[model samples]
Target: MLPVSSELTRSTPVVEYVIGKRQYRSLLEVTSTSTIRGVKKKIEDKIDKPMRYKFYVKILLTWSFRQLTWTGLQENRSLDDYGVRNGDTVRAILTRTSVTRELALDESSPWRKDVSEISDRDTGDWPRRLLHIPTMKSLTWRPGNRYGGKEGPEYEAPEYAALSYTWGKYRDETAEPISIGETEWPVPRIEPTHFTVHDFRRVINRIRRYSGTDFLWLDVACVNQGPDSDEGRLEVGRQAAIFRRAEKTYIWFTTLSEKDWPKSADPDYLQQNIGLFEKILNDPWFGSVWTLQEAYIPAYSYVLDRAGSKLPEISGCGDGTSFKTFTRTCTWLNHYSDTPRVSAARDVVPLLRKSGILAIDSGNPFILYGAAARRRATNKNDRIYGIQQIFGFQLGNTAPNKQTQQYDVNELEIQFTQELLKNYPVGSQMHVFAGSPNFGRGWHANEFSELPDKLPARFIDIFEEILRLDIRRSQNQDQQNRRGLSHLQCLCKFEPRQTESYILGHFSGQMCAFPDLLEAVPESSKVELLVALDYHKDSEVLADLESSVKYLEENTRRYISLYTHDRRRVVSNPGGFAFGKRLKNRHKCRLAVLKLGVHTRSRERSHDVSTFIGLMLMQESGYWRRLGFCLWRVWHPVEDYDKIQWTEEEGYFT
Candidate 1:
């Protein structure tokens, strides 16, 4: 025993210590001068454990296993003699002898009676008819008789737990045949020395004991991987439903071991254990594409380390007694901040939150597309098909169904975008465009270039519409604005009445309307009408402005003037003109300009000139009820319009 120093007894500092790996919150604080034997007594008192069993303390110096060392402390010596300090970890390992019988792995094992094989018919219909899921009889000790039972009644699908794990590289020669009751199933080719098979056996046994059910749904054993068939594709489509309907989902991380667990009874261990749990969550299982839905959709989920030890459930249901109830409650709690403590397995919470959003309103599937793009899939097509169910698209009936066109990735992407635009409003459509690669990354330019070649003719028209709304003029100077005012005049021979009266407006004084001035201006003069529209808050008004701009753009030679009060301009260029010089002076030419409001110094730099044009057209045509004033500006066509560097002051018709 080490000798205790005289200073240790004089001033004792309270030190926090963890008892075991499972109890993170069950921490005990004792003074530095407390004897090892005295600390044990306190632990017993805190845990309500009998003193008949012996407990030993070992310090954890580092998180890595290589750096971990155990130093035994004599029961009679104080912690100060062993160099114990405040906030140091002290692990308690029960030394009492207890016999734990391992489950026998023979052919006649009792678990064999509960095993069932998934039939081909069950795989055909998939989630709609979830009966007879496959279960492995034993992880080891394979028997020659693959099918142990005689002809019997077909097993109906029952409540079962689903396994989510990564399948590392495997070879044909490495495959092992394991018995599933009566059928001999070939286990994936995993190396034997790695103890994956052994760990799987232990996991199955523990799950059975804890869940009180022997039925389990493992993808490798359940899905038929036969070549030259569409069954695999069909199964992939039904993945969302399969995981959502499961009683519970188990996420098995091969990287986690006994070293990562925290004691359930030690409260001080809670802080230290967070780092270990974070490492466990970083395992490749969380990154796998197929595991995203599996980790989230189920009513209850649990995580297991390599040692078959279960991690604390992150979510809980109401009543908080059962794991399922606790998970349900925790899921709701995660949405709020009252409970700031995040669970170690909270990585899957985002997927759960998204699932809830999809269920409530799946009109905009753009977010789902973005989420799917971030994940990886073995088959390129599976990238889109895999997330179809999450967006509420049904995986049509079995083979020979006419709806197979939906499975095509190209067709599916188009359909998804089309549905998004159709079901949502114009603002939401803009948001989808902002999030999608086609518009977000400027990839739509390439799509537009391909035009009616790679894309459908209808899509070409759609692209044209979007372009007209986004840009005042296309790159090609020869083509007139397709939907401009000239086109509107050609389509409908309509004339407007002169407006001599004025009304109070929001930003500026009452002014004469533009339609009244149009009749007074000479037709031969280089006259241009500038219509400043309100593109601030109303979506309907914005849409009208877009239509009016398209009409004005068709007459390219005619000077079209527009100004805006929007602080942050949505459109890059408002007017068809290259520069704002044409509206700089009111004496140069006949130009009728309207101003609803003035642009502040901060907003002048990003102001959209076209927004004013659209806003003015809406007000003059009586399509918009808002008040505005009509002012006149002189147009001076610059010799080098493109070369002119117009400042913000000259850009706004002040």
Candidate 2:
């Protein structure tokens, strides 16, 4: 046993420690002079028997996973040597298997406090410069010219490779500063100062081995990063073209310590590495907004661990294990399940590929909105800037522009929503149920004028007329076939605060009544529903609604059901629907169903289910704002459309 410091026996400091990125919290008892290796042993022992997971601990500089004060803790060094104090939080990272290599792979030594001067000479309309890394020890950058489109020779042997990564917060004092003309660029190092020639060479060699290109175009190194930089704003607009023109793109996922690495000679090396790849897929790099287009635009993309190895080398499955294949496999694993956190990063590229909208430049705004919403950006406006390029349209104003400062997120969001609707073709019959109801410069209480104003005015008018016709027919039929069902509690008045209330109430009440009307009908239908609330900004009202309606969790795409206004007994078929937030102190809500353009394909199933997409709306200052969207699969054929009642013109609750 190692000797503890003789003077450190007063009281044991109980350090709080968390496990991995999931942050499973627990406590560690230690004297102030406990050696770093000894604490690691205690952490390993804390795990329940049967799972002997190995771990390495680092005292966080702050309450974040990104910033760490130490690169690797010396085994013989006591916690006090690193200034570890009582009640401080340390992260214990778990490796997949036993490690056999030394942990000297962090390549942050080249980064210094002084700025590296680079030329600001203009090259082309897009990427201004590219780093020419001919060898591991040499680094040179030169102006970059625009690539000839895909048919050009650049498609095969491109001028440069692009880099996509998360710019995590690091200690500002230790960050690398680069000067391009008048702009000062500060780049956060992935690891603290622990530079060794061997480790730095290993990183560069591995990147060279996988990417096949010596020239790299990284945003931090190339673009002007000043707040009011026109160059930065211009590059932001051309990101899509820059990425699309690259020979390939490299995604810099968090580097694993070389110390926890398994040897190639290990029997389970291949499987262990695959499992490690799966875990690292959950890294925060995958959740950044800018990486979405970076992953999708490149003809080929690679995932590299800065310290250890490239993904393909780790898999040992040869080049057959493409990045796209891995993401698709993970996405498929959680397709029927509700593991959105695991699937959120994997969903973007696959969904974009499936939509096939990129080729034609006409994409679905709903899909794009859903994708953008799932991602995160330090600056709220970056989300708008990042997604706009994916659709081949540049925002009128982009980052570093004075107009896009932090205080203008609401205005930016409203502008982005309007631009999205105006630029894309989402069918004249469809309307986007987006934006906060309480935002903007209108007396309607939101930035948006009514849906009629945004969409083709004639189209919304005609659609409303079709609903008016249906309501008149339903009223006439209701008088002739009047039953004593009016006594049933009106579904509009039924205030259900729980899923059980919705599930149980549907079976007990008259099917045609108000609150019960929103419930799935025909009993035989298989309905899968989900409610998505902005987890970070959710209000108590939305929290209660989410708890009351959600049967599944971790879903990015929300689902909900709304009953048709028609009182006729309808057969229901299995379908899925998503819903959003409701107003805090408002109960006067109504539903409107709009028919999407004609479905022409012949039905393959015995009975057809016509899909009716509905919106839950609330009146604010005489105009309506959407609460959420719902999809209903009621068994109404084309001939029976007259039975559906359109809510009254102004949506006055009956």
Candidate 3:
């Protein structure tokens, strides 16, 4: 017979245990040497329950509120062996018992009801308190089944894991229905047929098998896609919230193969597999505008390969790894990839920065949009709608309370830019226009050209003039020359300058002499320079010289300040100089200006010349911080400043 002690003993240690919402403090005769089973018995007696149900005692090991790692107390070990202290709080979590049941999808199934009905609130006159998202079918796992069966009353928001994937080209019209116990439920119909039921089944099965969760919130099955349906529109608007509420999000990269994964234990093998890993990351899923929020919003997100194996969490990739690490690796990998989609991948940086997932100093939406312009979205309006969440706007509207307003694709694009300019500082907005490649060219030209009168015109005029020159020059050039000219145009667009008087005055006052400036100027301009110097005493020419000098100094300082504050450091490859560079010498700040390309006397080659100036400030630690960059064509020598002219007839700076 087992010994039973019903009375409270003074020598017993007091322990606090939590079961669901209830907390219990129990005094027992169990010692530090007492096994976990002994403690469980005490808990059962305190709660007045039989020990027939299986439950585990879990202790919180980490402080992460969103994703606390809970370690289970070993039943065979003593309380002290598992690190249970006198007053430590332990949570009892009951595990579901194994049961075999038929999975049936009928009208009574929770998924069949409208989302609005699921909520308990009945706001009769209130303008639909919450969005009515369509109910999506989810599969639950059953114990003792090889192919786990679906078990669901329908998942409440925050109860299921969400899936993010690229549909690719496999848009089958119809396939076999998924088996739910003995009955088969018809797959949710999707128009334009982007995926089949078989595809859905594979994803559902994999998620259930690996995650040990039966219910999954998949966009393809859950979101109604009818063009005119209110359900579809509402779902689109609530997308951010849906993803944010998910317990965990699973990102499925179709291109990732099981064979390519290197053994984690093998260092040499992992090194060789880095290239393949990078290539796998470059898959189209990373470039999709819609997946950006799906990847970042969830508290716990996992990347799954084709075979359902979880890829290493982005944080687990290590400092030696170089897949463009962000503050949170999972967020970075979800929103970015490599190579073919580098531009689109970079666009997410500013959004991440804005969302607080990245450092606050990173650039804003206006600067990022240019890089994202190349990303593909089947619906052109999605280009604008996809990033609304990042800007703190609800889907289809700038704010949640505002009435949903549908606009044409072009109008939506214009409104997005206008909204950005309205919210952020005008100076930063201008700087983005100056830095982005797509802002003042091709389709984006008209948007920037029609800026509201409140915005300063100095920067806009500069971009317009540069763009006009590029367009005129390209009309006469071959395909190769046009491509080179296009690149030059982008460089011209990014040339940083300050139009604000207070900041401009401070920058203009700083003086630095360049002895080699004359040598860098074209020789043919020597005579023109002599002619200009002869008239230096003239007030107009003298004023022009001083004004030009002030402009140059201010522009140089502006670029440097922007570079120092705006650029991301080279964390992975410290030696590379692409984004920013650290100096080997630590004593003082170094300023270097180089004339890029050959200075030519020919009128045609003048357009090809550009100046490259950089400023590097060295910290006491001996590392250099890159401060700024200035790349632009100097039409003529500063000595002949008055002679340098812009002519409509010539269509080029002369």
Candidate 4:
């Protein structure tokens, strides 16, 4: 024991170790290139106990007098990879590992590692787990600065593709076993489960083979749907950002079970029977509200069958870009079929290509809510959550309720509208747009839903018009950029009267309420009688309605070109023009006005010459609900300012 051999000293270096906060330390002789796992094996041999499942290794550092800190190390990496030297102390921190195989993604999976230091957690750069398709391993991926800053060359994030598909009804309500790495873990039977074990195996194998995507983020397997659902809710909040940052988003259509299609089709098959292709393309996948954001966010999105084969017809449209494919498909489908689903698919094309660019790059939500109007979701809140990302904002608190496992759609709408207000400048006329006739929410209003049929399939036509007219009008980019941000120029705020019964606003000329409103009109009701604005068979409305339509047309023409192409639809289509048309007897229906605020025709010209823009509303259960947007001039001058009581405060619409 007096002298150790020179060879032993050269080959094995003594490394110090501190277990947890205990002062006890152990010295182990190991090579400089020994892996963290290899050292852990030596420690287990010395103690005759296994620590892989119970402890994580960390390099303990002492900088100044009694100043101590530690950096966690990956078990598979070597000490040399982290630049750990001999005599450096490493700590073994005790931690709990996932004990059951039933948990879809086990925290103790060998392929998983924590890589939080370099990740941008603030922007949701990290997903909880990623399924490594090549290895068939579900790896835990925590990306944030939450862990102490530990710089290393070995620990770096990998690029991944994300799956966007509707969670269809389960084939059978039974637990299916999935092989995660070498372990066969049982997938839990949750409501709205996506795939059976057989289906999952067949689909993922195809995805890997066809798309050439090695890493995938499939929600059904990646997200935890069991008891620890808090983590699942957190994952849901980060989903939009995850999709935005993903290398590619695969739009998964039907599995095309052998029973249905028998064999995969080529571009010729789709070209030969374009109707079946249209039917295939218009699967429930395209009808999903969630898929809208999924389809539009990524830089490159490929439409794929569950078999993992890219839709030959769509991928063949252009150089594999969705914008090009959607444009060509919309043109082709116009001649092929005019089914409701086909029309809905056509409506989504422009939305994905707003500002004549990809909607994700342009950050334009001009038609976001409108695009979502027709898409279906089992949950009501998804209508807002689905499209909010296109607007460059994500609702942090939109997770499903804990007890009910659903959302309070009413409360969620308020938060959504408020967030939308932050994105636009003050005095935005977007608030005045008509919401979905089916939905009662104020934020649901927009021109897209009002006249969906009127929209031009090609948004580039409108974008070109704006650029061409910009030279003539000499409009600046700033003005053009902020087009939809403000329409009611000199808008003043107004408050609703607190009384149970109060006059809404005065109407001009002899008028009669609609037959439906006559039933709701009561002596004690707040809206005693909704004075009808004369319905003109040719124009939007006889008098008051013309101003709103003109402003909508003019502003859109100046900034974007959608309205110019379909001005007639705005004027004459019974269900397309005004709130009155939403009711029965479209020709006889009259627009009823509820005054929002007064705005000068031109503040530069004269503040005295002002026109008040009112909301086109309908009475329901003694309260008024907005049906569409309406504008009209005030017949009487505002001599008594106190009686009108207009302030610059915020005006909320219902």
Worst 10 residues of 2 by lDDT: 480-489
lDDT of each: 0.38, 0.39, 0.37, 0.43
Q: What tens-digit string does per-residue lDDT give for candidate 4 at 1-654? A: 011223223123445543322112456777658887898788768656556465554443211001122245677888767654433345454323332222233344322434433222322445667777766666665432121112322223455677887763333455655656421234454332355566666767776775566677887667665544666665666676677545556666664432232122233443444444344445666566677677655545666655556654344455444433643444444433344433433443443322122322222344455556555567677777776655445464534334225557655655565554333321222222322332334433332332222233343322222322222122111121111211233232232222333322222221123322222222121221212121233432333344433433343332212222223434322222332333335434433443444433223333333343344544454444444433323323432322223222222234
* Selected candidate, larger TM-score, 1 vs 3: 3
User: Tens digits of per-residue lDDT for model 2 on 1-654?
Assistant: 111223322123455544432223466668658887777778667654222444555564221111223445688998778766543345555544322121222233211112232222222223654544442111222212222221322221234666776653432444443222212454324333332334444554566656677666677556665667765776777787677556556766654443333233222342334344344545556556677666655534665665626555323323323454444443333331223433333334333332322211221222344454455567766666766665445665653344354435655555555443333212211322323333322111122111221222223333333232222222221111111111100112111112321110001111111123233332224332211121113334333344434322222122342221111222222234422213222344432322212211124454443333333333444433334333333344322333333342322110
Tens digits of per-residue lDDT for model 1 on 22-128? 11124455665788888778766765655554455544321111011223557889876765544234555443322101112345432234324332232322242
- Cα RMSDs, all models: 24.7, 25.3, 20.7, 18.8
Off by over 4 Å in 2: 1-126, 135-159, 171-205, 257-284, 296-300, 313-322, 329-376, 399-407, 424-589, 596-599, 602-612, 618-627, 632-639, 646-654
The TM-score measured for candidate 3 stands at: 0.42
Better of 1 and 2 by TM-score: 2
In model 1, the Cα lDDT at residue 643 comes to: 33
Q: Give Cα distance to truth, residue 108, candidate 2, Å.
A: 48
Clashes of 3: 3
lDDT (C-alpha) at residue 280 in model 3: 53
Candidate 4: Cα lDDT at 55 = 56
Q: What lDDT, from 0 to 1, does candidate 3 have? A: 0.37
- RMSD (Cα, Å) of model 2: 25.3
Candidate 3 lDDT over residue span 1-654, tens digit each: 112235443232334443331111233455556787877787777656656555665432111111211235567798667654332234444333221011223445433445445321211111111111222332322111111213434222113556787653344456444333322223344333343455556666776666555556665445543455564455566665556544456777666665654334233343334455455546666566676555444434666666566665333444322122323342433234333433344444434433323211121233334333445666666666665654445535433333346666756655565444333212112221222223122212112121111112222333323322332232322111212322222211112222322101001111121212312233342221100010112233223323332333343332211111211221122221211112212212432222211112223544433322211111222222211222223444343433323111100000
